[model samples]
Target: MVTDKQNISVNVVDYPYDTSVPLLDNEQFFYIRDEKRHKGRGLAAILTQPPSVQYRTLAERVKNQSKYGFPSHKLVLLIHGHQSFKNALYQPLLADKLSQEGYYVLRIDFRGLGDSEDCWDPKLGRTIKQDVEDLTTIYEFVSSEACKLLLGRTLTLDTIVAHSRGVISMFEFAREVYVPNLINCCGRFDSHGLLLKAARRSPTWEADGGFYCHTLRFGEWQDVWIPKAETLSAGTLDSSKFKEIDSGTWVLSVYTATDPIIPITAAAGYSNLFAGRHTLNIVPNCDHNFYGLPDDPNKLNLSLRKGKVNYGVYLVKELVEYLKEENQLERFYKTHQLIKSAKNEGDVRNRWCLPYEFSQISNFRDVGGYTTGSGTQVRPGIMYRCANPNEATAGALDYMKSDLSVNKIFDLRATNEAIEGGIIPEFDVENLSFNNNMTLSPEEMAKHYQGMFLSSYNFPQAYEIVLENSLPTIRHIFEYVLDGNVDEKHAIVFHCTAGKDRTGILGMLILGIAGVDVDTISHDYELTTLGLCTEKRLIAKINGRGDKFYTILGPKGREIAAAYGVTPTEMAANVLSSKYEAMRLFIDSFLSKFGSFDRFFYEQLKFNKIEVEKIKFHLTI
Candidate 1:
């Protein structure tokens, strides 16, 4: 129902420049004010009116003021490239679009460009180092109390969207500042390529120390001095500097496939360096400035033109989607109270209802205290799910043995997985690998599952495959409980690498057999999203195995991946996410075919009525 209408008001303001930085006197930036009010309608107005007329309004206001209230206002900073003003290319359009989306958008003109004061120092020019200093000055001013008073609201500078040469300065600024999100539009990766192009244009410039080149600035052509110092400063940049950026910063590199300026291969350099934290989006049939091909039928040129197909819209689209995800993640963290839980051990255990907290372990929690359909509760301290305990501290192992009385462990990993991630040597562990009873050879099975785990869209299908092949493992686990091996006195813990996918399936089977509803089972699986160690392991696995799976896809696989608009690492992160819908869909499909959990146990798992009764008796109280 939302239309692309300019409903927000933008204000242009000038803040005093940082006196510490030389040759910068005044700086100017534009910020869009979000007019949407957060507080409820006045209570005095409601009470002054008759109850019948104002009751609905009061109820609506009350509903709006609940725990999930209005989203916090976020500030987005847009940086322009060299020889470009703040309004160049997509900057103005993007700023308006983001403002319409309820964000406080700031589009700044770096010194020596646009409406800002010029830096005419002959020796300094507009070097990358100077740009970084300019950025720092602006960043510090924004974070100051004076700026907050001017805005009338406290804001967080969460995202930075930069174009071309500005991307280099953005990353350089990130070396010290910790902005959560960054967008790179057509950023050049090869500094040597830039220097070579400049050299070809001005052959005698290096010999003469500097040369004047014609550049388009503010709708006019002017001869700007291209200094040798600026070129050398840019040439000194390399991928090693990218490593200094925070590892937690999420990066989005958006490039046009047919860019006339920077080669498309520069996109790969960013994806390679940022690996787990990067997303690459290549818009097709667009130029360096996001202009599309001309609408003429016979036109074969790929240069920027006033075409009907505007690719800058696509660039803004990608930026909006990435920002939406980041905002959702921030909301999720706040809703789940994970900000405090991630810091304090006591808070994590108390808030998440965890009975024990381990310094070296993660996603460890008891699967209990849920009332089943028949009014019986699943007893606490009897069964648990956790990540691999290979790295559990010695004190944690002893605590598990003595305080928790965990006597048995069922590792649900494959043999190769176990070899790669070793086991806990303290417990009486059984390797109930999920790959058992599969008819395919190990090589074929690996290929089959690897392809399935490549994308989150295929996760439900992968769960079905795991269910079909893991019958023997399921039967072994149930028979162990049926044989009076595990009891209330001695608990059991079952796990995989991150205790999410495979462990989730096992937890589903156990709870389903205990007469727990599907919704509860799915929600229990969703709790893995809050695990601290799960995210860390996801990053590690993506960096380690992302390329291997991509290469295994071959040519046809790559074509399919490109069609989906995702890179290999992005797909890997998707696969590892603990989405509630995936588990719910898997359960829905299983119930559709088998009718009920009882029937599934009798037919697929080959458990008799007596054994099923024992499972229920042992799992619930």
Candidate 2:
């Protein structure tokens, strides 16, 4: 039996997980939180080296919560089948078994199942779509701040294992959310297919995609009419469409030989769809619940062939083996797709963008092979930027507080805006007063403005600010860069809210001064719009109110230019007009004040000269 004897540290934050809050009933679900404890032989540790990955964190909620050396770990969140939550005795037992073999388990009762606050009812006319939403919400909660608090910092979720109906909900969740590992046990196909088969057998089944589907036959309304086998058999599983993820994401499919819900052929078909990316295990003699007993209410007559059954020690061993691939796990899973997106499209989920999570307003990104004058590209993550920290998640705040170890935060927001938003909480909130706010009253400015004045006033004001209020701030930023902190565990993050306008202007100027081309700067600045777009659901809500402003203003170029307080022309010039009048004046004035910009950076900031040069070389080349 495994005995956790080490002085395991617990870091749970006291956060509430309330169930009464009204759910949007639209793509939002809840993940039940359950923890079980028992004894076992120590499971071989996986994901040990990546200092980034939290390992063996034990929570105080488990039975024998105080045991130390056992190396407390997190259980995968498992969702049970329809009516399955009503009976989760098997889940805890499974968790116990896995724990004996070293698996911390968290079996959740789906929102509508078991002791969960919500319940699904055909008479109430609840749609499966609602269930899907509830599942997603629950999934997020499981991995969110409130869930993390429950587990504490010492133990965190290492994987998510979903069963049957839970797998369907999780499949939806995986498409939208990012989880490292997923284990599918006795998973079935989609709801339409599952319901269709039931409908054929019991005429009461009716198609329900939620609110959109309802049918009346003669004088009565039939519950469901959709056929499952016909719909799915017509088209194979579309695994190719899944978001391109890194190889580090591992998938394991576990099926029982006698499971009626998921026959061996069907399981094999699903496994084949994932092919190289997935592994399949079939348990022998066991029923769907994996317990033996012919007359058990929970048992199913799922026929098992000797060839298909590969249960017991072998399945557990394979799971342990696949999870231990050191090389893949060591470097954080940066999928080729993720790397590409971050470099080309500015996807926040990209590996390079991970740094942004730490800074409240950092326009954090990877500076991949962006060509310099010398035909080289800056290394990703060596530099980052963002809007002011008016809003930051607790996880983000902590990253800034410690891991970032940043030396400075160049605030570009007018002092008024900063105060209005409340003082940003940071170790060092440097006030580089780029006090570029317009001095003229709205009336006076309106009278004098012409051309893009009313339309482009914000852009010119951005320029004016850089020329007037931002020079010193730029000098300060340069000094910070030259301080040689770039190579250390710390760097710098600076921003103005709407990180686009002032922040973009400042970033462009800084990169230009450092010899990064204007085109590249414009490209980087424009990418902000991608992240700031309101989610589709919010937009739909607005549309319902006859709102078209977002739809109209969402033109790619317009959005990009708007972020930086300039037109696309200004952006092109910022790059193409490197020697243009505005740029020349800004660069010349800054240099005059501190010799060359590089000199100010090197002499003023304590940065290592070589590292500064290296940074410059990457950007300029």
Candidate 3:
């Protein structure tokens, strides 16, 4: 078992202050000598005199110490990666962000790299263990300084947050020592192959045999490495073994699909490793170091970078929430759970406008009580729908880029809608627009019901064409899903504008492919009327309109269908068709022209097989 000495083992040292000229953000450089070693300590820096404004920049800013209930008003050490400590630009943004969130952050110069002295141990070969020991000393020194600043008041080291190699060191110290909390940003494993990948990309650790090497270790159980190999080895670490670890510690592991080195799939696996209390978060396209990288021109390189997405600013906010929640330092607000009143079960309507600026328009939500044929309810977050995220808020965009962690976005909007919207942000957004609506606008098709005249325009050619057009996009959505990205463990959201029309069509298709009855699909589609617009106002508008005008007309499907020769019987089939096989048939017939759906999705839409599977699972089981 690792010792609690990790948290309490740091030595106090009088670090030198870098009185060098300040940087763009008023950041100043400083260093601390190894009080025990009595040598020149490596480079250290702090972003001082930051804008003294709060979250929204209120008139009077509150004092940092009193405002945030950290037992004291001082900073703890911050540890940076091999390259960042020396280079001002490469420093992990998490440190400054955390400092802004109230905790004083330290960007430490790890032993043997950056501003620190070279290693004394030869076996480890510039490993993170020495850095862990250094951090312990830093933590102890900071804790003592904080206590002294408080005039004999006592306080504990509240938390340690690390990224990349630094994350490994933090984990090592936490496992061996006693610390209240740890947050791992892009934690890595101990596999040589994976380590090489990170090393190739990392500007700092590339020369030292990549990140980690996997040497065989003997044990009574399965291949037992250093037990804490994950913290020791960058490539060969296995988080699966964490369940056996027992410590009074709280761990938060955040990952993004776009992370270049760390596979997004490994985030949950690593988080699940710890038996102790934990939280695992996945951001869509973040890189191994948590910085959003620029897109690569080559397709393979682009695919690799797709998981390294980034969110602007809000990561600090999350850390703030995490600190408060874990320490019970802030009041928690329970979301309102009042039972909504509705005229009937079908009348239920709920809309959750997400908190980010760029929420996936393709990601819509479903209530938990919608029962399946087997009498089981569809789980919330399991499946979702939304409009094209061409206009997602910055906050919403960040949430999707850094939180939702979805594998694919199925788009059914016509080519024109997409071209008008411009190319969706390439790094975080995937385009899968396929539909058979060749007739450009509602104006062009006003006189004829392409699918069903009036009630069900039986225009098989137009219907088949439109449906076939959608096949390519849906194919890609499902291909990526089946590739195992969207298993039950992950949630997916699909959508279009007004939560009806294209969005509704996709929703109904999913339900139909899943064996949900027609009434449920229609009811689900109709729920948008309530969720998006006020009924009284809509009714008033319809009543005020002349008899020649239909309320559901003018770009609305119901209106277009009413104007066509659609019959009640055909309408019921479109609205109420429920078997999975039936919906599959409809999709298959449409895709027949474009080859299989898988071909359309993978070959045409550019999504991998994993992305497709995620969407397919929604239809299967």
Candidate 4:
């Protein structure tokens, strides 16, 4: 019995205003656009007074009895994402749901769809950027009217709920504007992956200009062939660019347990990119569109209590609850900021630093939880990386053995460095040396430090040398991980002295191949300074003990060390430090030289295709 007549009502609620004077009493359906597009699209919006409450917003104050409604209040904006999707799909249901809960809501559609007018020319290609532009225009209008309605009182936008592809526009808008809260539902960060799949299915989509995207709509399959140019121009979802986001913008990623266009792992991928800035809320038994499962997939399983479940109501409820609670809202964002600034150190995962009572164990932390573009996350608590575990506390060693379930340790230090540092426990250790004085000698190392005191270029070049030389050793490390006996719960630790240089390069290669972004890799490498500052200082403390350490440094190195009040060894190790740039440059070289991380694994490392899957499956979920 549902018909076009079932379109959501445009009735806007009004109250006692200057009745004689004209006011925006009814929902206004008008045209809005960006600076360029004079031929704009339709925007339907309504602002209403907050629901009368008996208590003050923050509590411990007299409740307002004024008929005009509370001046300072909560407001929400709902937006549909894809140009193909209509606002009527969920706008009315959400608008009413939020309004009943004391929020003034405004929902809108992008141009060229629903009630919204088409962009002047269809040939301009409806890109996500245009949707962003349209959204920006609407927000400006809504905010202005909202401020007036609230009488200049502060309006806390609980969140702007954007669905699917609409999340792309919302994220883009927040990067530039002040978006207080954001909810991204089933958003795909890797647009290329979708296209690649499409190309595989159609075989001629990319070259022929379009592809058939068969999607389920209204319980029926439909051919939704969109142009390749339009999708490509929408831009890829590179969340690394969102690191420096607006201070006020708190992001919450919510997705159904089942997804069609985007993978279930996409949520984890976003959290990986957003790091501490994002939290996840999974809606069980629902698909990408937020529809519930009709028949339980567990109908055959009588051993477990399970049945058909729907996320339709549960999804919206979680969102509303997140907005209401400050703890849930600010959790991930605060955590992310703390880690990014290196303000936290209780756990290595908190800031990716290895805590130790002694100087040997540095940069020790799990390397899993990084995600590939396909939404697969490197399983957490599995792969750990660090500096030498030589002379590690028994308790610390026990924690790694038991908690991390680490059975293997790949030691990347040269035989000499191992002998000098003292060998780690003989059991569970593999010496995979990269710098064996093969190309760079101890004198050359001293010279490199001396030259480095003059310029900063040698730091990343040192990383390049590790990447260039440690081919077989790196292959074996992955092989250990890919071994059939290993599972997601099992972990292995890789280390070298200082863990910031050789350890960092190896860490970067592993994480990079695992699909971690450059920013995260840099962040992980930079965590070494927080964990090893004392270790670096220990070098300076050995002032008179190691005279040979200074003698190896000739003159220039000695001058740099003395100026810094440390030995030449300290000068070399401490001067390099754990820099974000060092790891970043290393990854850049990896990508440039190898073409792709996976290709480097298969072609350069000579890993079989089956082994590659084993590696990814074991490493990522």
- Model number with the top TM-score: 1
Q: Can you give the TM-score per candidate against the true fold?
A: 0.46, 0.39, 0.38, 0.45
Runs of candidate 4 exceeding 4 Å displacement: 1-354, 357-360, 436-457, 536-574
Predicted candidate 4 versus true structure: per-residue lDDT over 198-274, tens digit per residue: 66667887687876565433223466456766667554556566666654356889877767677877787878877
How does residue 496 of candidate 2 score in lDDT? 65
Tell me which residue pairs clash in candidate 4: 42-117, 81-166, 276-336
**lDDT, candidates in the order shown:** 0.65, 0.45, 0.45, 0.58
Model 3 regions more than 4 Å off: 1-29, 34-39, 42-77, 86-97, 121-125, 145-155, 193-246, 291-312, 325-621
- Per-residue CA lDDT of candidate 3, range 1-621, in tens? 111222222223333334232343424444444455324443243422223323232112222323432222234345554333432322345455555544455565565454455444434544555666677666555435333332232224556766666766777676655454677777664445454655454544534433333321111112211222232354554444444332435677877678756666557666666633678877544455544656633322322222543352345456666765223211111111111222245433233435222343432444223444443334444455654556555666555445545445555565676677544453334445555445545643443333322322132333444454566566555555555566435656565433444565566555644444443444455444334332232234334533323322345655444443343444433322222222323343444455554565566566676655555444443
Candidate 1 residue pairs in clash (backbone atoms < 3 Å): none
Candidate 1 lDDT over 3-102, as tens digits, reads 1122222334442232221221212334332123101110000000111212233223222322221222356878888666665677656665565444
Runs of candidate 2 exceeding 4 Å displacement = 1-75, 86-90, 97-104, 120-128, 135-151, 154-156, 190-192, 207-248, 292-621
User: Clashes per prediction?
Assistant: 0, 53, 118, 3
The alpha-carbon lDDT assigned to residue 501 of candidate 2 equals 52
